[model samples]
Target: MNAIEVNVKNGYKVIVDNGIFDKIPEYALTLADYTTVTIVSDSNVAPLYIERLKKGFLRANKRVLTYVIEAGEQSKNLSNYAAILSFLANNDFKRKDLLVALGGGVVGDLTGFVASTYHRGVDFIQVPTTLLAGIDSSVGGKTAVDIKEGKNLVGAFYQPKGVFFDIETLNTLPEKEMINGFGELVKYGILMGGTLWKNLLSDNLSLENCIADSIRYKAEIVEKDEFDNGVRALLNLGHTLAHSVENLSGYTVPHGLAVGYGIRRIAKACKNNGLLQNSEYEQIINVLDKFSLTYIAPFSDNALIRASVKDKKAFADSINIIVINAIGNCSIQKFKLDKLGEFFND
Candidate 1:
């Protein structure tokens, strides 16, 4: 197992490896002395791994409860959030008990939000089953559910007790979900160009190493800017526009795919504005194509801008966006709410 330590509230280790689900109880015991564990999964994942997890925890002499939500980004809403809280309350769960997020980004986000708010706060760990969650949402303590207005508009920065990545889970994912993961992988390659970018270019990377490297880079950034008041926002390299793509699609577009589209859009805008060299722009486009991340939303530039303004990062008059100055390097740029047209206009 490759362990990457993220220094946050108290600090936690992100363990990445194949078939690590059986060892979760040993890891959880180190985080806290909890007696009960509620494994919150999604419809798709519950049948596959819930029993395995429950049996493991039960063997460790811990009370185990399971709650499964409908799968998809659509499930990350206030109604489901309320339902889970009711499940916890009805079971008489205490703050000392634990919550285990046992699915992809949706399960992790919703479960993490519940852990953060229930009883003021409760202990929870992330068992991210999808590539996107394993690389991005499962770390960094950014837990949230979507509101009607926008994605992740209602949530908190509640850190998980620990995160475990079972590479085996990726095998059961649909081809589209696998594609969804590559979207974020491309974002990491662009942000930290080096071995990662080169490996992505050659497609000669091991999945475990790629995941560990991404988590390590994010760990360093989160340690530096835990509250997202500074450098950490760079992690949003393609998210500003990605969120818009998701919103316009009514979230039909998976987030990682939207992010891939976001990165392409930003790179194109930068190239036209002479901020990015043509050679680098082509490199970006090529990598995206290699991953089959060539999705294009039907919306126009003006429509994208309108949708993006509703993002949580948007201010009353301005919003901060990330722009790639070069491959592996990005900087946050402030755009006046209306002046975002610069990203679309030549």
Candidate 2:
């Protein structure tokens, strides 16, 4: 159990670990005496590891329920969210019950949202199956379902009891998904300096090693600031335009890819704003290129700019963007949507 404790605002401890599934019951036992467990996963992951998880929970003499949904961003909607709630309702899940989110960000977000609202909130655990979930979504406790208006429009800040990250599960991930997740790992390197960034660029580092360190890096930040009131916002390094691209792409582009392009665009924005040097921008682009991330989008500059204006991070008059001043450090800057096109044109 390679666990890093995240001290959240509501006094929740989010433990992020690799291969911790073997000790799931033991971890839950330590958290609460919940008699029932609901494992919420997607179609892709359910056929693979749901039984193993269910059996483990059953071994602890607990009643376990499994809820499987279609795997994709499109499934993260009101319909699916309602289904999860209905399942919990039928099962008579109480506050003492445990809600286990077992899949990627989509599963985690949807399940966490249900756990947050169900029975006025229940103790939940994150069994993040993808590299992106392990590194980013699972640790933050920001759960939500997407609305037609925007992404994560309906959600809450519900911290999980723990996060179990199994590196072995990542072997089954599709290459596109892996590359998409690698974009998020790179975003951490761009924001939080230290060995994590170094290991990401190191040729000798393996995916397992990167995943472990990335979880640790995020766990450290979440421990200090669970909410995005301050430093936590730095975690949105590439998310501003990424969300816009996701909306404009009609949910066709994956989150990781959109975030990858958003990172590059933000770097360009920073360079134009005199925050990042030309060499720094080149380095950012080079790393993204090395990861095979798509830095350019299919939309026109005007379309992207228009989409960005509707971003949730955008305030009344200015859009809030997280920009890297240099490698390992980042800050949020407010910019006018009209001038954003200059960054792309520049």
Best by TM-score: 1
For residues 5-98, could you state the per-residue lDDT of candidate 1 as single tens digits?
A: 9987679999999988888878887887888899999999999989988988888899999999999888999999999999999998998999
lDDT of 2 by residue, 143-230 (tens): 9999887678899989888777777788899999988888899898788757776776677766665666777678777777776677
**Alpha-carbon local distance difference test for all models:** 0.89, 0.81
Count of residue pairs whose backbone atoms collide, per candidate: 0, 0
TM-score of 2: 0.92
Candidate 2, superposed: residue stretches over 4 Å from native: 11-18, 223-225
Each prediction's TM-score versus the true structure: 0.94, 0.92
With candidate 2 superimposed using the best TM-score fit, by how many Å does residue 332's alpha carbon deviate from the native? 1.0
**Best model per lDDT:** 1
Q: Considering summed lDDT, which 10 consecutive residues are worst modelled in model 1?
A: 337-346
